[model samples]
Target chain A: MKALALGILAALILLTAPGSQALAAEASEAPGAKPLAVGTAFPDVPLIGPVSPELADSLGIPQNGPTPIAKVKAEALIVEIFSMYCPFCQRDTPTVNELAALIDKRGLAGRVKIIGIGAGNSDTEVDIFRKKFKVPFALFSDATFAVHSAVGQVGTPYYYVLKKTPQGFTIVAAHLGLIHSPADFLADVVAKAGL
Target chain B: MRRIVPLLTLAALLWIAPAMAADPIPGGLAGNIYPVPTLPPTDSQLAVAVGSPMPDFDLPTITGGRVKLSDYLGKKNLVITFVPAAWTPVCSGQWPGYNIARDIFEDNDAALIGITLDNIPTLYAWTRQMGDLWFPVASDFWPHGGLAQKLGILRSDGVSERALFLVDKKGVIRFIDVHDINARPDLGPLLEAMAKVHAEK
Candidate 1:
């Protein structure tokens, strides 16, 4: 038993030693699967959610089944890929809430709509985040990771800004990590979406 | 002396293997694939039944402190939660869900302490990803599952079972749930248990 304990202690020290951090660094720096770039047409992916009546009305979607990205009447869309369990996402909750408010504060709510896909979270978990944060925006469950894969998501707290065009919606920007500031992030999104 | 060289080389390779294959993120939403355990029956040879006094423990926490079970005896109700491991799927979701439910416990005048067999560094990396878990996450590592073994909830694999013990202000265990290792315990029952503990006192 003492030998086993020693073995585990050795394993712990060996695994967590400062020199071993390179493994984590390498994996984090690994290039993600190619993301959808600017000017590329947005693929028609059905967003699965309870689509609130208000959101449906705003998106020009009927209060019925899933809403498709192509059907949104807004000039621009911000789809935040998040996970309820992500620390960064949890820390950024207030910032995201601020961003949501900024759209209304800037009078961009009608032209720019925002929603979130809870990657790897169940509906119940997403609802927990919504209630805990008092988030005003709709959040959808992506338990099967379909939405994450469709959007080429690399990690949680990712974002994709899409702009509506005469032909179809095109990718405007992709962002990773927390938004440094609500005003600056809003300004960047607004500039990128050309709205 | 010549034969010692190859043995030393083998030991070096063995040491390097785990570090090289370490998960980029210790406990999070991606690149994890451990099969969930089937839900076990409530009664077991490896469980501390309700109505028992919880054994006092002073274990090291991931956040650089030691927590004792007796510390909250008169001040607040205590909920001791044991998860199977840090990086498993169900366990990963369990604490993060609890992170946002601090108000529920506060309302019930209860304090939560999470215990796992994982060492401090492993627990630190795991809970760091979980986001603002207000509770103390104790590591029952030095004696290898010491406290968990005392509670009879330590699995043969050297990890604790997914168990919850609610101890009242008097330090008597009020409710116990040795839940299915694979499933996240419903918060409703826990809240109900806390409410019951408060009503009785």
Candidate 2:
């Protein structure tokens, strides 16, 4: 009876917490569309760019062409959906860079690749974001919101871990909002992608 | 009873954690942005023209300092932006987007001044969600859109139109974009104009 009372009390505190309530309110306001679920086939997103020589070598794609997501040479891929205007994305820039460094530290640089899609941002906007944050990954513009719509219009700073298979790319994990711990997030990505 | 004490304590921490992390700005994804209805495209007429001397004004900033258009005349080029109001949709997203474009202004040796009809306290509360902005935000509140009225972008609803003015170091307006009241002005063109102005100098 005492344990039951404690559980109920704990549950009550969580339920009534101002932060939780605010989160719930915000969640409701978010689009009802669900993100690409894990175990689902990832779409072949066409990314446009004046792809830098370094990014081309990293993804093993041509420097001047629209590269499809599935065509990128990688055993596993981390897709970060962000917006140049998103404060959370701005705050998470360093952490996401740290995640990339962590990937290199784990010797997963060749096998695991990361890229960012600037939702609803033009090439100029993406360029500004890239330069401002000194982002170390290849970022593509979704100026027309085509990629955003393709990815279900989920909120900014959304992450997707996908594994390449003979069939296609399959979603391994999908996360929304700020990544609290880059190390843990990379660990999860590594484990889920089996890399 | 001892076990219950720790459990309650843990519950209390859980309750306080989110509150501590709560952002003062209300909305979630991109700071405290509230979704507002799409307004009419262009609401007001442009009173000032390109090549005309921009009407000078002394306005109070959110930081409690006063800024005069004349103060920047001989020193730096100016890009003055006027938004309709605070806490609304396009207005909220517009300034934060400029946060990343600081280098563009700096590259051209230009200073950006964001203006809104909202008073200092309201602007302070609304801008807190934008984190650290690279420019000063001024409130044109005393005569309520006095500066806006001088520039002739004040709307019928007692707010200014969403507009931008690129003023050269000579205090002569080089470009004027009385943009649609409902949408954000594109940064690319503004940057291009700033570059052109710098080239002329």
TM-score of 1: 0.64
Deviation from native of the Cα of residue A66 in model 1, angstroms: 4.8
Instruction: Give me the candidate number with maximum TM-score.
Output: 2
Please give, for residues A6-46, the per-residue lDDT of candidate 2 as tens digits: 76677667656654645432221234456988999999988
Quality of candidate 1 docking, DockQ: 0.14
RMSD to native for every prediction?
Answer: 10.6, 6.1
Per-residue alpha-carbon lDDT of candidate 1 for residues A121-194, written as tens digits (9 for 90 to 100): 76666777888888888787777767777877556677788889987678888877677688988888889988
Best-fitting candidate, scored by DockQ:
2
lDDT of each: 0.76, 0.83
Q: Which residue segments of model 1 deviate by more than 4 Å?
A: A1-56, A60-71, A143-146, A165-170, A191-194, B1-58, B62-77, B84-97, B120-133, B150-153, B161-201
DockQ of 2: 0.19
Clashing pairs in 1: none
CAPRI-wise, candidate 2 is: incorrect
Stretches of candidate 2 exceeding 4 Å from the true structure: A1-33, B1-32
State the local distance difference test value for candidate 2.
0.83
Q: On a 0 to 100 scale, what is the lDDT of residue B130 in model 1?
A: 60
TM-score of 2: 0.83
